[model samples]
Target chain A: MQETRLDTARIRAARQAIDPVFLDTPLYRCEALEPGLGCAVSVKLETANPVRSFKGRGTELVASLLAGDGRNAVVCASAGNLGQALAWSGRARGLDVTVVASRSAPAAKLERIRAFGARLELVDGDFDLARERAAALARQEGIRLVEDSLDIETCEGAATIGLELADAAPTFDAVLIALGGGAMATGVGHVLKELAPGVEVICVQPLGAPAMTFSWRRRRVVTTDSTDTIADGVAGRRPIPAVLDDLLVVADDAVLVREESIIAGMRLLLEHAGLVAEPSAALGIAAILEDRDRFAGRHVVTIVCGGNVDLDAYHRWIGAAPAHRS
Target chain B: MQETRLDTARIRAARQAIDPVFLDTPLYRCEALEPGLGCAVSVKLETANPVRSFKGRGTELVASLLAGDGRNAVVCASAGNLGQALAWSGRARGLDVTVVASRSAPAAKLERIRAFGARLELVDGDFDLARERAAALARQEGIRLVEDSLDIETCEGAATIGLELADAAPTFDAVLIALGGGAMATGVGHVLKELAPGVEVICVQPLGAPAMTFSWRRRRVVTTDSTDTIADGVAGRRPIPAVLDDLLVVADDAVLVREESIIAGMRLLLEHAGLVAEPSAALGIAAILEDRDRFAGRHVVTIVCGGNVDLDAYHRWIGAAPAHRS
Candidate 1:
């Protein structure tokens, strides 16, 4: 397997370069959840920041680098989170950010992207069409085209979460990451394998969109005709080549969970942990629920990657029945 | 007005005596909430800690002091949050805690009190009866009796929150604090009056339990026959004399909100701020909605004091109708 470019030394010092708001997120052990999971479960809540997601760490580092390098403009394709993150990070560093997204993206995320002072371009089609538009726009404007999982700076920025988790807890059996563009999974895995070598790094993906899962298992890039999942954060129709290489190097195991399980996980997080976790953020909890026996009696840590779920959709998807009827 | 025992000097240095987890909570500015409040709104999320409440700050500080003073045994009457908080804090300090609660107290809080390893005594009446039983038990067992709003140490500890908020933002028009047993309200008020004197210190209470509200306005203790509200955290039929004195001296204004407004505030917090605030914690938002003109075009800060609502009752009280019906 080819070596990944993520560095542990840089992750050790990443906190200094990254924004303070994204560092030292709450790592809470909810005893209420132990009975359900049959294991000691802790959540590193990454949803309480300015961007309400873990994307800020990497985005901040990259935006700071751009500021130092005198690159004043950039473009990126986002489902929602990365766009908001880059916009916030860019504004903080006085850099111009242009975010391209599908017109079908959730208004909750799009509103935040615009609120953060980024120029938003909405394509008529899907995420791939938005990506192509972003690439074309970057070339036309003579600016950089930023992609989440493919950037070395982004990966190294994400590694800081692993750096923090290792420093916070002395030991845990495993750490679960929600598998999406593979930036968080591969970046966190790289840090844990080096700092907390005893930990087993696990990646969880929705069964509906499991390109990374298939690629990691088959040892090559995997592509699907289309993605169909409610968890837009973890939905990938085609796996990036470089992210595939890093996923193989970082993850010890990969699990695919059904759509219902993802909804159940989101509910569990709300009921037990007293937090609102978006569908993609709850993928770890779903994986554990799918195979309770495997995680039983073991201590585990999971990251709540975001909390940008549209309230109306959240209530519908989480099986929120009318209390009067119940 | 009688002088409050809360000291600003101690509050500025209180972090040294408190647990690191309860300090420096997330202060996020949500743009979506801005339009609703007709002003910039920032939330100091005090619910993401181990106990899921701001109670940890005072409880931890008092626990440390008790440990230092060689008081190994203590008893307190709690409606749930205080019991759970004392249990967790006592365990950390190697002190024994006995909690007294009314038999009708919510099972969610009772379960957590027991989980924290506190010896719980159940009374057959209301919170007033529970307090009486706790006092009787303390006399019989020869242990110290601790009451939240009556204790100077608790108030001083709560003041730390105000110190941090003042340090966080250079200025804001006002701050809204949910008036419960008045520990947080008085403690935070004392610090802000000392440091951020220009900022308005507004206390919010439920219309069903307006003892503190009336007492603050009258500059004397007030008592009510009964309390009826969904916000148990702020339900007080009889105001503590010491706390009433502190309230009169600290609070610039007091607002009473109806039951429906409190529920609406809880919903606003969930939808706009992306948080699960119990009825009491959402009082700040309730006050804003009650008189939008008062806070219009101003930057205000509010504390989400806790997130310990029972999921089933939460759904019922929040008017969570089925999506299909909508």
Candidate 2:
């Protein structure tokens, strides 16, 4: 891996520029979910804010950066969460934001992106192709292109989570984060490794979409043909190369969890924790369920990253999971 | 109304001494639920804190006061949220806390109360009898009794919600609160009346527990022989006279919604707003569903006041409510 360029100072500076709404999110003990997970768990809930996701922290920081760059327009490709975050933050910073997404992105997120005052450009292909199209638009329009994990600002913004979790009283033995495009995993992993060297950063991904997990194990870029998972938020077909390099230097371990466990994880959070979490957000909890002994008797922390899900999908997945614990 | 003794000054003062966790909770616009509710809706989520309820704000404030009053012990009657809140705050204040609760209180809450290091005394009958038992225990032990809504500090703590809502944008034409012994309603209603006099405060209660609504309208104490509702958090059998007098002066309207709507409201929050609200927390949203015309075309605000739900009951209610929205 390349010599580490990610610094804790950059994350501290990012925290200084973030919107107050996205800062100081609820980090509390998940008392009800502790017994089932076989560990004392404290969850950093990133869903209760404006966009119902953690994307706001990074996107808002990036938007603030664009405010002074003599730029009024920015383009990005997203499944949904990043688009909503960019749109919300862009509106606050008076930037004209454009989001490119495939036709099959969740309507809930698509609607939110538009509601947040961003121009939506629906593509006829996958998120990767959508990214190519977004780049083409950025080139054609001469606007800034912001991609998650590729942008230093995005990574630094997510690092604030590590800062917060470190300050919390629970001295977590390990932190399990969902491996999406690697922005959150890489950012948080780097900060935690810097602040608390003893803490292990475990990156978790869906078995159906194991690009990042496989890449982290191999210490190189690994791209998958097609992703198949209900956790669309974290189902990345390709891991950003830079993000993978950071993950190799910072991440302690990686695990792939089954699709069934992911659905059960969402149900577990709602039933046991009394909070709603989307499939991607429950990746860490799914990892624990998949291998409880690995986390047994250890204090663990997980980020409930996003809570945006289509109602039909949410209900169907809840029905597919095992019946109530209580 | 006894010349309106409840003052905003007391609420503001209480804010100074609150635990930082309980202050400045998430208050944001619910974009997805706007169409369903027929108005712009903002939700102040009081459930995201340590106690998973708004009771912590009041209990913490009261605990701080108890620290200086030559008191080392306190007793209170609770269904679950209040007991857990008191126990958590008492532990922080280094006080001996005894909680008296009925046998029927939620195990989720009871377990948390015990976990927070409070002595739990379970009674045979309903919550009213539990309150009587708690009062007797307090008298026998010569300890201070902290009753929700009856104590000035408790009401003042809740009033901070109104202060926060007033500070936020998306100004509301009316604010709806679940009437649980009139603590939250009386507190928030008083503050909103003082700060933003144009904003109307509408107190909502379940049809099964209409004591507060009836008493507020009649300007007297109203007692019910039985309270039958799934929203055990706000199921008050008898209205406190002092709370009723305060509500009579502060609240502009009171509405009682059916059980079906309450369950459906919970479903609505999970589906549209992506939140898991307790039956009582969903009270305001249910009221909006019942009388859509009353809130149509007007910006409305509601409090998701608590989220401590029994998993068995939560699953059953989710099954009972109407199926998926998408």
Candidate 3:
């Protein structure tokens, strides 16, 4: 395998470039979760940020760089978290942002993007179609398009998380990351591979949206006819080649978790960890639960990538009693 | 009124003494919540710690000090968060901890305390009765009872929060804190008053449990006949005189919020901030919603003190559709 050159110095710079709100998130040993997983598990709370996701780090770095280069506006297509990140960081950097999201995107996510002062353009098709619209818009003068997984800067921004984890707990046997478009896995994996050479980087995806896992196994991009998963954050049918290339070098293995396991992960996190993690973010925990034999007695770190679920959806997932009219 | 002398130097030392997991929590601008309150609102997420509450800081510090002084076992009475904090920190420092609680204490909280390896004594009475039992137990030879709000060392431990807020945003017009036993309000307020004298420290309590607010108003410890509120964290009928003394010197104003408003605050936090805040933790937000006139156009910081609600209780509070079995 050809090793890609990911600048450690640039990753360090991204740590400095990104807003402080997204940096140094809570990474603590989850005592409540450890017993069930049969291992020492530490959770990095990326959802505690203003955007309720890890996307803010990469998007803020990209937005800052763009704004510094005299850009006035930017556009992106997102399933959810990235759009909100771009909108928030863009608003901070005084740049106008337009997000092209699929009509199927969660209402909570769409509301957050608009709340951050971004223009929303909902496409009638899936996320890929929204990406096409964003790409077409980018060709027009004065507008730059940011593609999350495909963008090197986005991955570089995410590498800062690895830097923090290495500084905090460098001796972890494995780090489990939820794979969506693969930016989080690649970025954090690259940094950990460099800093903590002994640590294994594992990527987890929902069985319904295992494009990245399938592609990684075959050493190429794999396109599925359709994707269906409650974890909308990782519900993708296509894999980007750039993200795949990085994953090949950086990731040790990729695993698929059942949709039922993902739902269980969400409930465990909410009840024990006291975190309202979105379904996508809970995939890492699901992976751990599915393969307890591999993780038993080993120290592991799981990234809670986001928490952007609507209250109603969250209630349904957690099996809580219906809302009362007090 | 004679102002009490709070040690600034000790507070700075406490910032150094506490565990890193409970320090420097995310303090960011809450964009989704701002327009509703008609002000720039920032939230300090104290719930991201291992105990999912701010009580860890104080309990850990007190436990460390006790362990250093050759103490092996400690007793404490708590509604929930504080006991969990003591149990967790005591276990970490190799100290045996016994928590006395009311029989009516939430099952989730009791489970957490047991999970942290603490002995639980359920008294068949209210919190006051539990406290009396704990105090009586503490009088036995070689056993020290750690009271939550009345201990100066606990308050000093909590002062570190103010140090962090001052470092993050020192120019805030005011900071609102939810008052239970008055330790959090006094500790954070004392530091803010010293470092950022211009920032007003406002304390909020539930109307059903207005002991602290009434006592602060009367400049003495005031005991109500009974307490009734869904915010179990702050449901106290008796105010400790020492805590009241600290509040008189540290707090600027104390306010009461309705139970309905507290429920509304929990929903808003869950929907907007993506935090599953307990009713007591939501009191600051409820106060803002109840009195928009005082907070309009001003930059305010609200400390989300804890998140330890059961799933069913949370669903009931947030008015989500009833839980669906898979």
- Candidate 2 lDDT, tens digit per residue, B61-143? 89999997767999999988999999999999899999999889888889989988999999988888989999999999999
* Residue-wise C-alpha lDDT for candidate 3, range B1-326, written one tens digit per residue: 34554577887887666788999998988888887788888999999888889999999889989989999999999998889999999998999999999889888888899999999999998888899999998896459989887887778878888888877556578899999887889889888887787888999999999998999999888899989999998888888887888889888999999999999899889878889899988998999999999999999999999999887777777887545678
> Estimated TM-score per prediction?
0.94, 0.90, 0.97
Ranking by TM-score: 3, 1, 2
RMSD (CA, Å), each prediction: 2.8, 3.8, 1.7
lDDT of 1 at A128: 70
Evaluate model 2: give its lDDT: 0.86
What is the CA-based DockQ of model 2?
0.35
Best-fitting candidate, scored by DockQ: 3
Tell me the tens digit of each residue's lDDT in model 1 across B110-170. 8898998899999987677788899999999999888888987778877888987887657
**Alpha-carbon lDDT of model 1:** 0.86
Clashes of 3: 6
What residue runs in model 3 are displaced by over 4 Å at the alpha carbon? B1-5, B321-324
DockQ of each: 0.45, 0.35, 0.68
Between candidates 2 and 3, the DockQ winner = 3
